[model samples]
Target: MWTKRYSEILLMTFMSITCTRAESEFELRDVTLHIIPANTVERNSELNLTCEVNVVSRGGNTPDLKISIFKNYNNHNPVYINNTRSNKVTYTIAKAQASHSGIYQCDVSAGNQHLYSSEENINVTGLQTPELRVDKLKVTEGEKVRVTCSAREESGVLEYTFKNGLKVIYKESSSSGVVQRFHSLTSTETAKFSCSYSIHVGNGVLHSSVSNEVHVVVEELKFTAKITILPSTEVIEGDSVYITCDVEGINKNSSVLSLSKGSRLLPRNYSTVVLANDSGVYECRAKVNSAERNAYKNLTVKELFSTPVLTITPAEVFEKESFNVTCRSSKIASERIGHDDVKYFIYRSNKMISSDNGIYKTMAKNETNGNYTCTAQVNNTIKWSQWITFTAKVLVSKPTITVLNEVILNKPFRIECRSDRGSLPISYTLKQNHTTLSHVQVSNPSQKAVFTTSIQSIQQISEFKCEAQNNGVNSAQTSDTLRAQVTVPVGKPNLITVPVEQDITENQQLQFLCGIPEGASSPITFKWYKEKNLSPVYVTTVNFTNAEYTILSVEGSHSGSFYCAALNKAGKEEVSNHVNVSVRMARWKKGLITGVCLMLVTGIVFAFVIRYRAMRVKVASSNGAGIWSVRPPVLDSSEVVDVDEPEEPNVEYTEVLHPQNSDPARVPLRKGTDTVYSEVQSTSPEFHDEF
Candidate 1:
């Protein structure tokens, strides 16, 4: 046994020496181990380990090669041991857990030979929960606010995450603390803030916790001063503009406010009726105690449309000559190059001839002799330009002289000079028998001159002529001569009726006279007619020069229509207005006849009264009683043969006697008589029944 033991030890020692030699040789070969990603990784991340050799020992009598991966956490045991056919090998962990983080090593072997590489370490940290704190709970507008974040516990490495209402604002990793700052705060900036801290423990394992949420509020600044502009910024020309500055949340009496246009300070706190020249950027500043506030705005003012300029080429043109006329806008308006801001119009003789287009062309004619004007406007704007007038000068025609009234030997007459066409301010000269009679100037081309003179003092056959001259610079512009014939003056006569008495007696004579209104002209005769259709029945005699007609005895047959006519030596006859003559008796005569009739009726009534008295006395004496007997008129039997008797007579009677006592049945007797009687009794049955 001893001898066998010794031989086995020697064989093992020799093999060990051989293995050491091979290990030494293999160790000399370049070998390296590398992690696939970075050595440091987040939790739950994949990891890979790779081992490579520069060259495999193929010359030596070596066995098959294999790669083994070892971890420090597993008692330095091999986590991955596999034989490889190539010089390089890789080990992968698809999902790395925290337990996989440790020191790692790879061993390279050929058969029973092996070598270990340098060790690599991977670490994992637990994330710490954070606490957020602020210097203040609220902040003022335009003021700065500060915030801070602190880790809950001491951690390996903490990453502080801060957000403003779910939006990540700041992210930083540090072993210490973190802070956030806000320079300015606005009214709309109201949000909650939270912070969280995290760390990687091992194998990409992440641990985190949220801090208590903190909210911040921003308040609007205090009210100070405000500015208001009246009538808006955009305005047309001549618009009333105003600006007012008011100080609020403070006392106006203690505050000083100033309004300015550019750098020039205004005197008043408010401006009224500002003009376009005042258009510019304005500022309103208010100062109370030491606080100052300012407001600014830009003011714009539009200009009113300007008067258009009219220009006609070839200033003076003759008939049938073509000319061009152009209307242009103001210089300030034309500078607006790209906009259709202005429109033009052309006027001739105060009437619209063209619109929109500024250029106008026309052939010269008598009809185009009047004034021309133009205007411009814009769309949706009330601005308009003033109308400009320019009179167009043109060539004229010859003048014509006319005699206005009849010419007499010793009377004054009128002569008018006229021209068909020309510009205003024309000169006219009147001539008689080729001698200058009078010179006159007419401002209007259409007007003429009237010359009143008598030819009695001058020579006979005084032929009148007139010449017209234009007012233009060209002296050659003149008119042809026009002639007038002279003749004796003859009047158109009118006859008038002479006034006559309205009332006339039947035997009274009536007379009428017809005379000319212009007084009688020599060699003129008058004639009278009874009606319009018949010829003159009476002609003026030697004594009746004015034409008078008389009736010896006026009667109703003389009432008829009458008219008169006057005829001159020139054979021109003129008739007077028709007159109707009516003959009437005097009204006093009718009154006298009515008075005579009244006198006769009075006399008849007096005689009737006398007769009635006589009859009453005779009837009274013939009767013995005081009763009266009214006897009806005796009629023939043929007149009253079948007449019906009336029940009672319509006649009434009075009692002359009265009773002494108050008894109606008894009648008192007269002083001389002893008899007493009642009222008279009627013989008819109707009287008894009525009683």
Candidate 2:
């Protein structure tokens, strides 16, 4: 035991200074001293000790540095005998005596700094091994064992120790001891009793030696029961585990073997089969005629699961149709559904779905059309299968189209295309007069697609149609054409006569020019209304067509509140504000009218303009604002006018050339063109100027 402890101390010292002395982490100025014969040696033996000094530069000696050696590491009062001074030096002691055993160190001085080396122990032993003897060679259990040790001469401290293998059973420390008494020797085998002595000399060194071993026998009965299992691997459910109990130093016939769990007795055998519920502390008992012993072993059980197979019924599915997916597991079917059983779960697109009986029956929706799988979980154990893809096909029907608003020439309107039954991402194509107008793709399967478009002319009845197609690659289904009519809507019309007054003379060339806003469909029919009645006037001499009502002459019967209504093929009509016409005198008194008469006519125009502005303001205030609004303007021919409202705030109008008419007889009148009839034209196609 002392030898082991000394080796451990040497190991700890070596670990503390494993690195070179120059590379020490703690900024200590020191030297490393290594002494030969680290432990005790016999007296009169040669020994050599070396001191290697590592110095910090403080302008002291370099190559020949001053280093002093001391005995017992006492630097305050140095010992002059066998002392030397040098950068590196080794001291040799030939035939060392007991007085030479002490700790040694080296020191170096630089200006006001001093460096010290670690102390090294040098032990010179003069003691001899003691003689050990026992009173008897054998002893019974509970008997006092006596061992005696003696040294040839008086030793400092004598230690007597008795050991069985590496375990110390008895020990005693005394000065010059002679005997050691051990009580109740119960060791199962023969033990060796040894004696040794450790004495510290006057120079701080301990000399020690071990005596010859004296073997003593201890008589005692030690019975043991050890259990062993055949298969060491973890035992799962439904597995048969074999357990064996071995009894030491007992004959099979003399000893009775029995197995037990808690208080219940099992089959009496050296080996037994372990059950699933038998997972607990099990004891194996060996009973002889007078002695009995038992040993315990722990048993545990684990659970496992089998893979699940997923199946689908009526594998093919249609849009808005129902389908079923069944996940069957033979393991689950064999095992009863207890609190510890695994529950089945179905997944579509990595999202869990409800299936009470492992049979997932659900309708085919957009969200439910993806790859599916299933998983089972019991406690912390879970297992899932690979994904199975499922795609649904939907039946497409013919698309029906209708105009959401009145479609006019050069006027924006919307045409809606709808499919009654189809999947999402359906494409819609709008055609006018057998030509493609716009193509729209509707992402939502349930919504209709609206396309805004306009017509250029109403020379012939325009035919429009819409078609829908599903986004399928193989034999993609398309819808039939839903035909519609593209007719222009009449804009708000303004009635303008030759004379801007209500009072007019007879026999004068009085013409009613219904100034329609530009971009109105051609061949518009006009109806002239009179005084307080909604019914139109029927005159035999006048013909009203092409937005113009020509009377060719004025009469007293026309003096009333006259308003006009314009209609086109769009099935919508627009009525103009009424103008009061008062025929007070014949043509002879027309020149004799006063300023008040002129003022009366002016007041009527003022009142009409004021009322129109009020209506526009009311419409803008009610809703945030609308696309069409007009303010009373200072009329001038040179100033550019605007009637068409911009949809966005950042947009400004720029002119583009309009396509010329193909018919020569119905050519539009321009300022440069001389035609048989006089026509008033506006610069912008959407805004018309009043005459």
User: What TM-scores do the predictions have?
Assistant: 0.26, 0.27
Q: Predict model 2's lDDT versus the native.
A: 0.62
Tens digit of lDDT per residue, candidate 2, span 68-148?
668865777654323233456776777665556677787765444567787777777676567877888887544566777
Residue 356, model 2: lDDT of 35
Candidate 2 residue pairs in backbone clash: 408-488, 408-489, 502-582
Give a tens-digit lDDT track for model 1, residues 101-181.
678887777755567778888543334456788777787555556778886344346677778778887787886556465
The C-alpha local distance difference test score for the whole of candidate 1 amounts to: 0.63
Assess candidate 2 and give its TM-score to the true structure. Answer: 0.27
